[model samples]
Target: MSKSAIFTGLVIFIIIALFPFWINFGKTAPVPEPELVGKAKTAKKCVLDKMDMRANHMSLLDEWRDSVVRDANRIYTNTDGKEFAMSLSTGENSCLGCHEDKSKFCDKCHNYASVDPYCWECHTEPKEIK
Candidate 1:
């Protein structure tokens, strides 16, 4: 190949390789961290560790759903042997009690991750009073 053609190809390859880094060079803002909302903020602890919950919350919720709906089980026993009622109506012990504001807590991470969970389709979202 001609020197000029080789140089042009090299330049193009360099630009393509560095384009992504250059585009995001000065973006120092950390990823939006999920904020704990409602009673969760003040709660002693969660059923699972923070990292576990963040990574596997969907699977956990699915398991809970199946246990409650399919198996007709209404109690969840944690690793520590603490039993919690799996009924959605018992908000305090379930999801809504801790995550009182779905918009602030759940929506933040879900929206950031572009995940559209169909949770609200079947379950009623708690109306914010204020």
Candidate 2:
């Protein structure tokens, strides 16, 4: 090939290879690892750690209430601490909302996990599987 043609081809190849590097230059600064910047509160730590744990279905609801709903109630200062669904009359949000069947899903999973949920202490039902 002619020297001029070869040089032109080489320049094009170099530009094509380096184009990505230059185009991304302005926004390509390495994102530094997120700093553990602030002093996390003990409650926050507990909540975060609890988030990592695998909770049985029943315990999940209770944990959700304690870690999240209760915190929301505290922060929002709402009259109703229990954020039950509109159809729910007893406990905050019907168990059937997620588990479908208390005995079938909730009890089965909890029993398999060897967890006796304390949910019965505060809530009761008509023994009707809805």
Candidate RMSDs in Å, in order, are 3.6, 18.2
Residue pairs clashing in model 2 are 84-93
Write one digit per residue (lDDT tens) for candidate 2, span 23-93.
98879454332222123221232122333524443344555567545465422121435343322114333
Q: Tell me the number of clashing residue pairs for each predicted model.
A: 0, 1
Q: Which lDDT tens digits does candidate 1 get at residues 7-77?
A: 99999999999998999898884566667776888885777777887899789888989987898988888
Candidate 1: lDDT over CA atoms? Answer: 0.78
Top TM-score model? 1
TM-score of 1: 0.70
**Off by more than 4 A, model 1:** 1-30, 87-90, 128-130
Provide the TM-score for each candidate, comma-separated: 0.70, 0.32
Q: Kindly report the root-mean-square deviation of model 2 from the true structure over all alpha carbons.
A: 18.2
Best by lDDT: 1
